[model samples]
Target: MTSVQDFATYIAGLPRVLASAAALFRDVEGRVLLVEPNYRDGWALPGGTVESDTGETPRQGARRETAEEIGLDRTLGRLLAVDWIPGTGRPPLVAYLYDGGVLDPGDLAAIRLQETELLSWRLVPREEITDHLPGALGRRVLAALDILTQDTGTAELENGHRVG
Candidate 1:
């Protein structure tokens, strides 16, 4: 039989993956909102890593990150996509994408970028999303947009390719 200490040790030693949640905001023109992080090469949705250490769930994390990154505290819509990305150097990543709903001109005017982490934000047309986001992330955003357009259920993805 395993001792209590042994069980704790085993749990602590288990491999862990990183998780993040993002909000997908769109303008009335149907363009997607993207932010350019000061520390990254490409633009990203308004969200960040889930504070799992602090016991924050994915939806909560998405809301918090959206408010922090863009100063938009509106209610988020349904889950759009979830992608499991295989690890390259760091641990694997599970990304949750939530709908941020459409923003009117007033809401768009009210956006305040968290300048410390973001350089700028823009609304990219569907065909131009890949130009801003690139790679797997671009694919994920496109898939999420497709889901919204088709009124389909949530998307499950591996490396940003829709699986089921």
Candidate 2:
């Protein structure tokens, strides 16, 4: 499993263009899975940039992230949304947010944390996501979740929101 820092270093060393997948996992109980960063102390949806080794599709990247980060076999749903993180000393990130459903809840409970990146994991209720997440990523994830649940074509976020 690749650590987020290692992944960032790898991305930093590459060319300016980058592609990533943000996989949103939801359970029947209506709780979403979120990972807490070790260094930043904030919650984020579990997923990562697409790697060359895994091929070019965002769906493939989402599947890989699920196995690597959360230890689950998930069925990839529609491409719910896309957002771009403007360049800030590093390459601009084009993140593809996908709606993903897990095959088993027990597998989620059995997740093995990659300590270098994630400090811990939690199943957070929709109403309480804002309290747990730190910043913009929270808003984006929640918006994506709303769009996914409603089967809507667009997600609405506040300032700095990006959807494609």
Which candidate has the top score in lDDT?
Answer: 1
List where candidate 1 sits over 4 angstroms from the true fold.
Answer: none
- Residue 131, model 1: Cα distance from true site in angstroms: 0.9
TM-score of 1: 0.97
Local accuracy of candidate 2 as per-residue lDDT tens digits, 1-164: 99999999998887776778878887778788898878776778888879955465878888888778766657778787676666668777777778877425676767887777788888898889879864666677777877877888855333227533
Candidate lDDT scores, in order, read 0.95, 0.75
How far off is residue 10 in model 1, in Å? Answer: 1.0
Relative to the unseen true structure, what is the C-alpha lDDT of residue 46 in candidate 2, on a scale of 0 to 100? Answer: 84
Against the hidden true structure, what lDDT does model 1 obtain?
A: 0.95
Scored against the true structure, residue 94 in model 1 reaches a CA lDDT of 99
Q: How do the predictions measure up, each by TM-score?
A: 0.97, 0.74
Model 2 lDDT at residue 124: 90
For candidate 1, give the lDDT of residue 123.
94
Largest TM-score belongs to which candidate? 1
Checking candidate 1 for backbone clashes, the offending pairs are none
